[model samples]
Target chain A: MKRGWIIGGAAVIVAVFAWLLFGGLQKNVVFFLTPKELLAKGTDGVGVPVRLGGQVKPGSVKWNAQTLDLRFIVTDGAREVPVHSTGAPPQMFRDGMGVVVEGRFGTAGVFEATGLMVKHSNEYRPPKPGEEAHEKYKTLIQQSSQ
Target chain B: MKPEGQLNSSSDRLRDPSAARPPRTSIWLAFVSIGAVIVAQTYAILTSPAEGDMGHLQKIMYVHVPAAWMTFLSFFVVFAFSVRYLWQRRENDDLLAASAAEVGATFNGLTLMLGMIWGRPAWGVWWVWDARLTSTLVLFLIFVGYLALRAFTDDTQQKARWSAAVGAIGALNVPIVYMSVKWWRTLHQPPSSPATLDPRYTMGLRLNAIALLLVMIYFIRKRYEIARLERATEHMAEAAAMGGK
Candidate 1:
C-alpha cells in the first residue's frame, strides 16, 4: 500500500512537470528568420515573436544616447528591414556587424526589436579598409565609449 | 589498521579484502587528475584568441562550457546507476549513484556561477527567466534535494532506495536543459562547437572539456571507493551489535 502511494505520487509529479513544459513551450519558442524570409511571409510574420538575423546596413545607424533610442537597417544582400530599438545599445554593437534582433515585425514594415544581441566570435575582424561603418557611427561609438 | 568493530568471528574480518589493502592507486589518480586539469586549463586560456565582442571576457568560456558539459555528464551517470540499482537492488549501484550525484551537484553549481559571470556583460543581466537558464537551475535544485534526502535518512536501505528514485526523476530534466535553447526563445546563444566556432577556439574548448571530464571521473571514482569502505564498516558495526545481543 505504501509503495502504491509513492508510485502514484511520482506519476502525478511527472505528469505535472510534463504539462507545464509543453504548455509553456507554446508561448515561448521564438522563430528565427532573415529579412528576406520575413518579408516573404507577408502578414504571417507580423505580430509574432521572431528572431531576425542579418548584417546591419552601413550608414543606417542612428543613435541618440540621451534618449537611448537607436535605429538601423538589417539586410540580407538583396532585401532590407528597418529596425527601431530602445534602451542603450550593447557596447560592442556597431554598423555592418552580424546581429540577431528579437521582437516582431510591425505592419508598418519596421522590425520592433526588444532585444539586441551582437554576434561575437573569435573570427570577427574589424571593418575592412575604407569601410564606411567605422566613419558612419564614429560619434555614437565615441559617446558610448566615454 | 586492524578492523575496529569486531564482527561475530575472525572469519568475517578475513573475508574483507578491502580492509587489507589501502586505496593507494585511487589517491595517486586523484593527484594526477587534478594536475592534468590545471595544465590543460593553462593551455586552453593561453591558446585562445581574444574575442572581438566579449574580448578578454571570452576566456571564461574555456572553464564555463566544459564545466557545464561535465555537470550534465555526471548527472547522466547518476541516472544510469539509479536505474540499475532499482532493477537489481545492488548496494554498490546505490553507492555509485550517490557518489555521482554529489560530484554532479558541485559541477552544476560551478556551471551556474560561471554562467552568471558570463551573462552579466553579454546579456546585461545576472539572472533571467529564459528557458535554458531556468531549466538548468531547476536541475541543480533537484540534485540538491536528492543530497538532502540522503543525509536526513538514518536507514541505509531506505536512503539508497529513496535517493535512487530522486536521482532517476531529477535526471529527466537533463535533456530538457540541453534542448531548452533550441526549443524555446532564450537569451543564451546556441552551442558554439564543431561548426560555429573557429578552429582556434574549438581546440581550446575540446582540450578543456577533456580535462574537466577526467577530473569528474577521478572525483566520482574516489568518492565511490569511500562509500564502499563506509558500507563495509557499517556492516561490521551492525554484526558486532548482533553478536553482543
Candidate 2:
C-alpha cells in the first residue's frame, strides 16, 4: 500500500510538470519569421510579437540624428519590409548587415521594431564583398552621432 | 592504506569503512587531472578559429560548452545514485549522490558565468528571460536547493531519503533546460557545434570535455572519501562516549 502511494504521487507530479512545461511554452514563445513569411500572414501576423530576421537593404537606411528617427528596409532574398525605429541603432548596425528585430507589424505596412539587435559574430568584419561602403552613413551618422 | 589499486578502490571503503587514508594513486590522479585541464584549456584557446562574426570571442565556446556538458553529467550522477540509494538503502550510494550534487553545482556556476561573458558580446545583452537562460538558472537553483536541504537535515537516513527525492525530481529540469532553446523562440543561439552536426569547434570542445570529466570524477571521489571518513569518525565517537559512561 505504501509503495502504491509513492508511485501514484510520482505520477501525479510528473503529469503536472508536463502540463506546465507545454502550457508555458505555448504562451511565451514568439515566432521567428522572415519578412516574406510575415507578410504572408496578413492580418494574423499584424500586432503580434515576433522576431523578424533579415538583412538591412543597402541604400534604404535613412536617419535624422536630431529627431532620433532611424528608418531602414529589411530584406530576405526577394521581399523587403520597411522598418522604423526611434533610437540610435547599435554601433555595428550597417547596411547589408544581418539583423533580428523584435516587435510587431503595424497596420501601415511597417515593422515597428522596439528592440533592434545587430547580428554579429566575433570576427565578422564590417567590410564584405558586395556591401555598400560604410562611408555612405557619414552624413546621417554625424547628424545622429551616438 | 591498501596496496596498488587503493586510491579510488571504492569497494575498499565499502569493505573497510574505517580506512581514512586514501591510496597514493588517487592523490596523483587529482594532480594529473588538474594538469591535463590546464593544458587542454591552453590548446583550446590557442587553436580556436575566429567565427566570421564572433571573432576570437567564439573561443569561449570551448569552456562554455564543456561546462554545460559537465553540469548535465554531474546531475545525471546525482539522479542515478539517488535512485540506487533509495532502492538499496545504502549510505555509500547517498554519499556519492551528495558528492555529485556539489561537483555539479560548481560546474553549473561555471556554465552560467561563461554564458554571461559570451552573451554580452554575441547576444548584445547581459541577460534575458528567454526559456534557455531561465531554465538553466532554475536547474542551478534546484541543485543548490538539494545541497541546502541535505545540510539542514540531522539524521543520516532521513537526509538521504529527502535528498534522493529532491535530486531525482530536480533532474527533470536538465532535459527541459537543454530543450528550451529548441522548444521556445529563444534569444540564445541554437547548438552550432554539436559533435556530429558541425566540426567547427569539435577538437577543442571534445578535448576539454574529456579533461573536465576527469576533473569532475576526481572531485567526487575525493569528496566521497571525506564523507566516509566523517561517518567513521562519528561512529567511533559515539562508541567512545557510551564506553566512558
Candidate 3:
C-alpha cells in the first residue's frame, strides 16, 4: 500500500512539474521576435537588446566596402525593419535569405545590429549541371580578403 | 585479514570458468563496427556532392547527426533497463542501465562537440542558449548526475534504486530535447528527416547512421560485460567476508 502511494506521489509531482514548465515556456520562450511582433511593440521595442528575425528583403541589401557598413531590410511578410550593422555578414548571407540580427533599434528607426547570423534551410543540393556554385559570392569573398 | 585471503580465493574460483573463455562475439563486433565506421565515413565524404551554399562543410552532418541519434538511442536503452530493474528488482538490469548510461554520456559529449564545430562556421558562434541547445546540455548533465550518484553510493541496492529513479527521470528529457526546436522559436533548425533532406544526401546519412548504430551496440555490450564482471567480483568478496566471519 505504501509503495503504491510513493509511486502515485512521484507521478503527481512529475506531472505538476511538467505542467509548470511547459506552461511557463509557452509565454517566455520567444528566442527571437518576428518583425511583425517587434513592430507591434512600437516604442517598447526600441533601444532594447533584442534578436530580430526575418528574411532580407529582396533588392534591399546595400554593402559599403570602405566602411564595412551593411544595410538591409528584414521583412516577415506583413512588416519590415531596416537593419544596419558593421562588419562582414556571413558567407551565406544574400538577398532574400532568412536572418537573425542581434542588437537594439536606434531612436533613428534603424536596427543597430551588433551581430548578424544567417539562417539556412534544411535543403541541401549541389550546383546543377552547367551551373557554378559560389559564383555570385566570389567577388565578395575576394573583397573581404583584401 | 583472513577475509582478504578468502576474498582472493573466492574471486579466483568465480573467475576461472568465465575468464578462460573470452568474449569472442564482442571482440569480433568491435573490429567489424570500427571498420564499418571508417568505410561509411569515407564513402560519405567522397560521394556526396558539395552543398550549394556551405560546400563540403555539410558533410559534418554524417558524423554529427548520427552521434546525436545514437545519444538518444543509448539513453532510451538506459530508460528501458532502468524501468525493468525497478519492476523485476534484477541486478543485471541495473548493471545494464549503468552501462548504457556510460555509453550514452560518451555519445552525448560527442554530439555537443561536433555540434559546436558545425555551429562555429555555420551559426557564426560556438554556443547558443537557444531552446534546443540548452535542453540538450541539460540532458547531458542529468545523466552525468545519474553516473555520479552511482559512483558515490556504497550500498549496491540503494545505489541501484537511486540510479534507476534518476535514469528514468533523466530520460524524460530526451523527447523535450528532440522537440525543442518545434516547440520554441529557436535559431536551430527543425529535425531533419528523409522527407526534409534532399534525396542525394539521404543515402550517405543513412549509411553513417547504420554504421554508428553498430558501433553503439558494440560499446554497450562491451561495457555491460565489464559491469557484470565487476558486480560478480564484488559479490564474491562480500560472500567471502561473510564466510570468514
Better of 2 and 3 by TM-score: 3
Interface RMSD of each: 5.1, 5.8, 2.0
Instruction: Order the candidates by TM-score, highest first.
Output: 3, 2, 1
Q: Which structure among the candidates has the greatest lDDT?
A: 3
User: Could you report the DockQ of all the candidates, in the order they appear?
Assistant: 0.22, 0.26, 0.57
TM-scores of the candidates are: 0.75, 0.78, 0.91
Candidate 1, residue B186: how far the Cα is off, in Å: 1.5
Best prediction by DockQ: 3
- Per-residue lDDT tens digits for candidate 3, residues B23-77, read 4345889898999899999988988998877788899999999999999999999
Q: Give the C-alpha miss distance for residue B102 in model 3, angstroms.
A: 0.8
Docking class of 2: acceptable
Over 4 Å off in model 1, which ranges? A1-24, A27-59, A65-69, A72-87, A96-146, B1-15, B18-25, B241-245
Per-candidate alpha-carbon RMSD to the true structure: 5.5, 6.4, 3.6
lDDT string, candidate 1, A67-113, tens digits: 77899999989899999999776655777776778899998999999
- Model 1 chain B weakest 10-residue run by lDDT: B2-11
Per-residue lDDT tens digits for candidate 3, residues A4-115, read 8648866986896587467887667777899999989999999999999989999998887777888999999999999999887777788887798999988898999999
What's the true lDDT of residue B220 in model 3? 90
Q: List the residue pairs that clash in candidate 1.
A: none
